[model samples]
Target: MDFLNPNYKVRNLLVLNAAGFSCISLVVFLLATQPFYLSDVIGVPPEKVGSAIGTLGAVDELVAVIVAPLLGTLNDRINGWAWNHSRFPSGSRILELVSFSVLALSLLGYGQFATKLFPDLWFWRAIFAVGVSGCMSIVTVMLHEVNNSDFRWSHMAFWRTQFKNHGERLLDGNGELDTDNGGNNELPTVEDDVFRIEEGPTQQTNKKHGSLAALLGVSTGLGAVFSVLFFLTLPVRLSSWYPDLSSKESLQLSYTLLGYFSAVCGVVVVVFAYDCVKQRRLSGHTPDLELPDTTYFELLKQGLDASRNNLRIQLAYVAAFVSRSTAVATAVFIPLMVYKFYYNSGLCGAEDLQNSLKVRSDLPLKTSCYDGYIFLAILTGVAQTVALVSSPIWGILVDSKKLGSRATLAVASAFGMLGTFGLCLVGRGDVYDPRTATCFILVSLLGLSQIGTIIASMSIVSSVGQTVERTEHRVIGSISGLYSLCGGVGILVITIIGGRWSDHWVFGPFLLLGTFNAALAAVATRRG
Candidate 1:
């Protein structure tokens, strides 16, 4: 509660930002886990579930592409207003509350309607995707606001310094900062002399924007706990409560419930949260922290120009995100393959198969290979987290010119590719007898490999983006969406092919995916 005070506004902002991120994470986790529950618990066929999920991915990609730019434009417009007015006159906080409320209601509807209307897999997917898209758009805007506030402060500091040096000299007898000894003869304080420097409006705006961005990052990371809680609830629901439902129905219900919760949470956020801007007396001194007044069109043009100028950096970001997505999609699909082809198709011991089938009847049960696959997923999460963390660390090194971007990218890609190969070997081989130890080792190695690739890709992009001027923090979300879109395409392709192919050759498609990822990594490394 103490942390929620205005004096600790930055910390409170972090908490709110993290809460939003947690919601996003929950959505992602549900997306990953629900397909399996559909096939295993509710009795949907593996191929059907895979196809349904694939379609959902395609929809997500389309929606994200369409909505992201629009959202970015909207954010730019809002920011422009905030800067010009020095406050959110239209009530930015109110908008945030409304958006979150809408999100929560949508999720609640999804959960309540699952058993009644969205019985079909595709319908459920379409609705879910739309809900997620809307929620994400609002979240993006909130993040942008948070960032702009901080940049405003820094810009104010810069202007203060410039005013002191130049404006002070013109003051007649008084050592005042302002030349005009108007009604109030308040001289510029020492603090006012430290931050002045006039240039383009964009430069002035960035000082505050940077702090806000940092706060957003920190808050989002911490608030991911709610998402974890949401995910934890899924296994219980699918396993215990609706054991008799078809896999498709169960998965649909699960996702609907998750969405409903998210939407409800979003609504709460929008309604309750407020962004309070402190009022200051005007002394002809620049507002200590203010954003730029660049129009949406100008910002859009600027972002486009910067992207075009730094094509290599943009490409690297795309490649890295794609590789990470590919790895995750492949990890998700492997367990499905095991359940559909190996578990029931007489690949394992008869007793084990019988038990698996019984478990499948009641709930989604992991095959003998389930443990291995999950182990791999856990490892991947860990590795990726580590890799993501290391990326910034390495980015700092690259920025200092102590390391080459190409070299960093290559090493990371090589490790990730090697991990992919390792997973392929495990799938290709018949090492099922001593499953526990073998799975642990393989999953760990795979995770390690993924980390390497992820970190390297991130480092390269960060380094390259920093080298370019006028591109700082612009279109970052849109660019991120594009990168995510590529991965979605990959996931759709692999899920479609892998689902059918698993019936014949369980390990073949995984190997092919690994190979493809490896090649992409190699090319990215070279390009970086």
Candidate 2:
């Protein structure tokens, strides 16, 4: 808790953290609800719904893989001069408004397109993909500013206020009173910096400031959990509360509410999020650690060159891929698997697929979708809840001397296997029986595994960045870009193939996850 006390006020920190939360909420809601949308509204066959999801997801991630890196770079450049002269909003802020507006609008028209979802919704999905990509890019940019931008909005102003309020004692070279501990302020060695998670009170403020950045990464998981527990179940809740509404109308209302919520979140960003580094630059202030005189080309080249033979960086990249894939696949497929289970058991949709609307014809369609929703919400909420809880534990372990980053990743992969393979073997067991308990355990374990990999992978990247930064300044950006690029690629691979396999077997995606986890474990073990 003390670590979260960055130099900035609480308002700015919350606004910055909102970007990550928004990123996951926007993505998770769409994916989590898509199966129901397709089955009930789009009228797609149950057997083919998986492929549709896969194809749509593949295309979505494809756009992300391309746009994220480019847009992130462009946003950084835009923020380079954010609000320098004019009274108007910065270019980056305007871009944010447009991006979130697109996202909000995209969320509104989701199931309304219906059968026209063929090319029309395909095109719309592409537009939505652009919105998603833009939102993701914005998160990256904000995270960069949070980490690099001097850790405050105004340093000298703060000092002046302090001086005016109270007569200051001896000040440090950087500014502000030096909290000296009688010669206990020297920097820690790389071992302590990279491997030790716990920091003493005398550690540098910049190091403590990393707590904000760490929170930013966890925002995605938090967003997913929030979505699963809230947004994904909205339609069902609506159906239960309002008996007159059809399942489709319930879904539409849920989306409508979510769209507005997204817009409001966007407003929060425009109103609250400030340009940290750019404001300092305009004020003729620079951070204590000045921006290194390094170009993007040099950063890219140096990062790439280092990873050419560097096993650690290579493993980090792999970890990033698996971590991102695990997060996304868990969000999309777990609910989908449950939906499929309900549909198969005649609790959702019609028994025949070739005739009338499979999910809406003649049956109590509202009750059916509600039933599936209840199962999915419970399963997904539990998994993501566990994921949220376990994420920081991996962070602690990596920072502890008990397990190095490599060992943590391998161990996480092993947990992944235990969960993914175990679930696959269990297949979609009866939800009402004793096997349900086993299902819950497997879900929790898989969630734990996912978070572990995510923390371990990013920790490895941070470790590699620390090691690589000595030789190449600002190279962390390149390494991080590569890490995200790989993660996007991993999502692409998993959704495309895993989606197809899901039709034949409800546990197909789990099998794919298990295979990927095994590969990650093998690589981490080999590298270790």
Which candidate number would show the highest TM-score if scored against the true structure?
Answer: 2
TM-score of 1: 0.61
Q: Provide the overall lDDT of each model, using Cα atoms, as 2-decimal numbers.
A: 0.45, 0.64
Per-residue lDDT tens digits for candidate 2, residues 464-494, read: 4221124322344455556667788888988
Give the top-scoring candidate (lDDT): 2
lDDT of 2: 0.64
Tell me the spans in candidate 2 whose CA falls farther than 4 Å from its real position.
1-7, 81-98, 111-115, 137-141, 144-202, 205-214, 240-242, 279-313, 349-364, 428-435, 460-479, 526-528
> What's model 1's lDDT at 440?
50
Q: lDDT per residue, candidate 1, 405-439, as tens digits?
A: 45544555555556556666666644233234554
Write out the backbone clash pairs for model 2.
Answer: 197-399
TM-score of each: 0.61, 0.77
